[model samples]
Target: MREIRQPGAYSYVYGKYEEPIATVKPGETVAIYTKDAFTDQISKETDRPSQIMSNPNPQTGPIYIEGAEPGDTLVARIIEIEPTRDYAVSALIPNFGGLSNTNITRTLNEPIPEKVWIYKLEDGVLTNNKRLSFPWRPFLGTIGTAPALEAISSITPYDHGGNMDVPDVKPGNTIYLPVRVPGAYFFTGDVHGGQGQGELCGVALEISAKVTIQFDLIKNKSINWPRIESDTEYMVVGSARPMEDAARIAYAELIVWLEELGWDKWEAYQALTQIGELYVGNMVDPNYSLVAKIDKKYALID
Candidate 1:
């Protein structure tokens, strides 16, 4: 059997992930065990938000894949996300999310039990709304690694990984992050039981699960940011001042990425402008996120 590594079980800061943990040629599978994104707090009965703010967003690993190098791309294909147990799902006041408008009086003070975390998002099924209740969709809130530059980033999303609370990042998804230093210093945290389009409330239906992933490398790709191929779509993750500016950075980078894939700059820009879509990944942190998606059918993957 091929050896699998745990992300939290090993030591890696910024410069350390470059060191190899285990060697794997192309097409090898490595299973990894991940701690809850909250690092171990907030379960089905525990709804206290204070505990969440205190703990760290402990990620799983920096499993050094053999042959990974700087300027390469580390493609992490999520095989499965197994939940150890159920947990509560909830939303908070506007002060908690990206759309924090002072005048908005509606706030989410209710702590939904783990069993009923999801609601029918349709039409009038819910008071004044009609929709069929749907099953809960779980995801990881924080899922990036160390920054090539100095300065410890808050557990929020940046070109480097922090608290990127995107919901589509689920099982059977593939995350592609640029290799700044060697080995790709990857980390993941803030797993959620469920979340909306934008993690507007700062947090998601937080929970922990065992994340199984397969890591592969794309050499000489020279990507400077992180991207993903979720089960349903492809996206680029970026954080910056003023949400629009951040989005610019993300899409600009995406354009460069497209160019590398053989599109001219003008064509790439036009395509992104016409068909690309944006998502508010997180707004609670100082920097905000805007993830853009380009249909996988239009792009090439090496």
Candidate 2:
């Protein structure tokens, strides 16, 4: 357990970066603490809009692992995500999202308000008004780490791990990230109780929360990109240009992964062609993400 003061530039959670609880053993559980996406604000029962601030996502840690090194894979298994309170708050700022660049030309569509609105899920729908529409699902807005290069990244999603707000990356899942630099400067924060795909409103149930995790070292799996495994599914994440292109890259990478894991290249290709699963992590950023997954037990293995 630790506290973070200034999360630095382009970070996800607010304030302090957290230190890993301990060297997580293969099946042991670890607990992690997190701040809200906004460093200074708290979820209050007010109807006012949050003041638009410079930084929205601040993260905790660069939790250095003792022997984590470059060319390695750090496997993180999420065990739990418990909210600190019953309900939380989130907001959408005027000029701080993927669509911000061209927002001026379409200001009317922009819903900037002096006060924020909170909606509730009414029978499988989000409704601030009893008559309006609803699209409600909840997820975290940021989960990532430092870049291999000397450069820093904003709290948004990148290969370095900032804000990759995907929906299915939740508790009881395993994440594998490539080790670019030594110790793999890892961090996490900006925990949302729930969020919909794309975070279209730019915010979710923002609040301070904690998580339990376990870490393991994948010895020689030289994967170039990130991958994840939930109890029921597997995902391969590729970040690159034009969503379709990135999606292709993601699938291609997974095929390579399957081959390297000892499948005959041709067989792996056939299997993937038959029943591989893929998803769009996010298409809003300059670099889109493609995630592919399959059940491990059923995945083609030699």
Candidate 3:
């Protein structure tokens, strides 16, 4: 397996022009070492976000997928996600988060107070050594293929799937991403030890991760957005403003996916109304994200 180590092989933006740090053939599996969202700057609990952190969510690569081309589908099957460190950080950053007064949503109220919390890895759980404890629910917070014409910031999520922060992007899940440029310049970072729906407070248990992934290509197949398949469910993700729009985009794509599975458009739409489930990714990024999902049993019905 090819390995891409972070700090050296990383980018803050997803762009077609960025040089790829490594290249691998289809069906090849690779191991990636990634930094936390703060890039290891907030290691200690006393460290402050404004005092130590500069850039956010540094992505692990522009990995060139051999022979990948526009309109093709890049298949990434996440086999494992292991935290390489013994701790994780959760913080409340001022001017960021869902309920806070942010740069975009101006208000008379003051921004939320900034504070930091650290979780120690012990007995397979992240614990505060007191009352709070969370299981090791690891997932990739930022993972995407580069866009063809735009040098988009890694902080935002869009068609090519940047930092969607969906908790469902975990091990044993295979995510399907769109390919808009040759080689597919793939990137991944922002591993979280655990995160809740919507990533409500704009942060999770941020930690470094060693992620093993298998890559393959679906030739000439194009998807409007990112999709995921697990043993029991299929999900589609959408990133946009006005939370409802995100929901619409996600379900719309899921409806199309159902149609491809032999269901009629109207029938798929009608079925989704009763069987569909929704998951919130992040509410803090430039564009909020939402997911529409369906169980495999109903999706593959005869």
Which one wins on lDDT? 3
Return the TM-score for candidate 3, rounded to 2 decimals.
0.98
Query: Each candidate: how many clashes?
Result: 17, 27, 0
Q: With candidate 1 superimposed using the best TM-score fit, by how many Å does residue 199's alpha carbon deviate from the native?
A: 0.6
User: Tens-digit lDDT track for model 1 on 1-302?
Assistant: 35344523433233343444455554566555545544554443335545454544555555556677777887777777656554433435324455553323345554332221222222212111244233457677766655676634435577765676777667878878767666666666566666666666565655566666677887787666778776456678788768898789888888887887788899889888888889888766767777888886665543
User: Candidate 2, residues 48-107: lDDT per residue as tens digits?
Assistant: 444545466566565655577777787877777766544456665655444543343345
Worst 10 residues of 3 by lDDT: 1-10
Question: In model 2, how large is the Cα lDDT of residue 253?
Answer: 74
Which of candidates 2 and 3 is the stronger one according to lDDT?
3
Candidates ranked, most accurate by lDDT first = 3, 1, 2
Q: What lDDT score goes with residue 189 in model 1?
A: 52
- The lDDT per prediction is 0.62, 0.60, 0.92
Worst 10 residues of 2 by lDDT: 13-22
Candidate 2 positional error at 10, Å: 10
Candidate 3, lDDT over the whole model: 0.92
Q: Which of candidates 1 and 2 is the stronger one according to TM-score?
A: 2
Tens digit of per-residue lDDT, candidate 3, span 1-302: 76778536468898888778889899999999999999888877778898887789989888999999999999999999988889999999999998899999899997788889899998789997668799999999999999989889989999999999998899999999999999999999999999999998898999999999999999999999999999999999999999999999999999999998999999999999998999889999999999999999999998
lDDT of 1 at 128: 13
